[model samples]
Target: MGVTRERAIERLAGRHPGRRGFGGSADPAEAAAFRHAMRGDHDLNPGVTPPSTALTPAAVLVPLIDHRDGMSVLLTQRTAHLTAHAGQISFPGGRVEDADPDDVAAALRETEEEVGLPRDRVSVIGRLDTYITGTGFEIAPIVGIVDPPVPISIDPFEVAEAFEVPLSFILDRRNHQRIEREVGAHNRAYFVLPYEGRNIWGATAGILVNLAEVLAD
Candidate 1:
């Protein structure tokens, strides 16, 4: 069998030596190989960080729903009126508040505040490397396994809609696209995974690419 839900959970539960910055490969591999490969090697996001900006700290929950249909990822579409990342597909998270104890606390708290996913319902497995955004935020993506059928009440002020994407679709490297854009005087490349009608790209897509590398098979 390929990577089973149980096996994926088990792998995620293991301790990973935390890296300073975010990085991962998009190449598909068997789960056993992928797990080992993630321990010491991955590709870092290139040329996205601006030289003059100070990066703010942020955290996000990479929520994996353990459903009977199949493993899926929960995502959110931000409201169009927001000032930052408006109308974009993203995880339920934001900049870490001073009251937050750590990255895990920030992730779970934001998940609850943004999407009504109670912290108690989430089973945090581990965290991915820190992703430094061009806009100047160093984000920690926390991987969590969630129980199915839990009620979600998304905050209308921040989230326009909430939806799930099949893990199988995202785990496939072929779905990841390398896209580029010119910001001011610089051109930068980033990852994009367009699903159905939603365009999942930038930091969200980069984190998904890291997840695919961590769990690919």
Candidate 2:
């Protein structure tokens, strides 16, 4: 019907390496659309080199869990007191540490730390796209399949609650809203996926949009 667990796994497994297995990979139509959309107007061309400005390396696990009907994406809401992204809806992840081998490792490690979803419980399939946020972080969205019934132990300091949204709901283009909003001194177009009264926007919503594009029939 719509975005079943088996179909999602089959789809992600088919993404051939674009750049080192994640960057610019163009399988399942095309990848890294974020590279163009996320860039400043001055850096519009695909060939334009990235600016020298620093973007902290970060990774997020886009966890998909199975259900009798279809798959649902696992997400988290940050605690209100956190210094950054407080009380926002997000995936289970954080900044990539130097000790980590790569983005995948960083994503899994962060997922484990933030939500207590052990690394072994997740079966990584592929990646969505590398998204660089306005906050100066280069994010790698690692797509993975998590078996259901796994215990969740959240770190209260970083996470307020863990929840899931049906993948079908996310993949449906009808729900993806692009709004022009004024920020500081500039107006910017951003994606927002509103679910069950929760405002899912920014990079987290962007990553979900990419997944929807990749898995669309």
Candidate 3:
């Protein structure tokens, strides 16, 4: 790809604020209202996060791997036995633990723990908007560049397998679709990115869209 790591960083820096959401959101605690709003709003399947609701803070690393041919994003398939989002595609990350210093630190730490990708091998360039899920998670999507690819060693309990999707493909909004599903007697619509026959949906898909918009030319 013609977009170099430096160029990606420059593009991210172009944003007025590093991230956005309710109350300039990124922290779900700042979540203002909970309504059935998903018409023009980019976020679909958003759940009720009343201002008083204390959402669990989480972070995920949107790892952009640098290859000679181009850039690709590293994603993971959660182990089928896991509780939430079992067997679904996701970026490497988890809840922000008390031991972690901040969102970035938690993202890097969780990444290393989940996929054995070293913290030192990645350079965090920027972030996408904070995303809230129907399951009550306030996710901080931290964008990072990974150079000098490392052999992935996945945790069997947390990840089933690790894979990559070309960044260019994800950047093309055309590759995404708005699909509706019935959840608890209600219809909820969300974006889905199909890659190699696998469907990347929900928050993972939303974050990918966020990345595409943030790095748009």
User: What TM-score should be assigned to candidate 2?
Assistant: 0.84
Off by over 4 Å in 1: 15-54
Per-residue accuracy of model 2 over 74-139 as CA lDDT, tens digit each: 999999998898999999998889899988999999999999999999999988756676666777
Tens-digit lDDT track of model 3 for 65-122: 9998888999999999998889999999999998998889999999999999999998
Instruction: Sort by TM-score, best first.
Output: 3, 2, 1
Give the Cα lDDT of each candidate. Answer: 0.77, 0.79, 0.79
Instruction: Tell me how far candidate 2 lies from the true structure as C-alpha RMSD in angstroms.
Output: 5.4
Q: Is candidate 1 or candidate 2 better by TM-score?
A: 2
RMSD of each: 7.4, 5.4, 4.0
Expressed as tens digits, the lDDT of each residue in 1-217 for candidate 1 is: 3456776776677656454322332343432233333321113333322323344778899999988877899999999999988999999898888899888999999999999999999988888756666555667789888988966999999999999999999988899988777767866667789899788987899888888877876
Worst 10 residues of 3 by lDDT: 33-42
Backbone clashes counted, model 2: 1
Q: How does model 1 fare in lDDT?
A: 0.77
Alpha carbon lDDT of residue 200, candidate 2?
A: 95
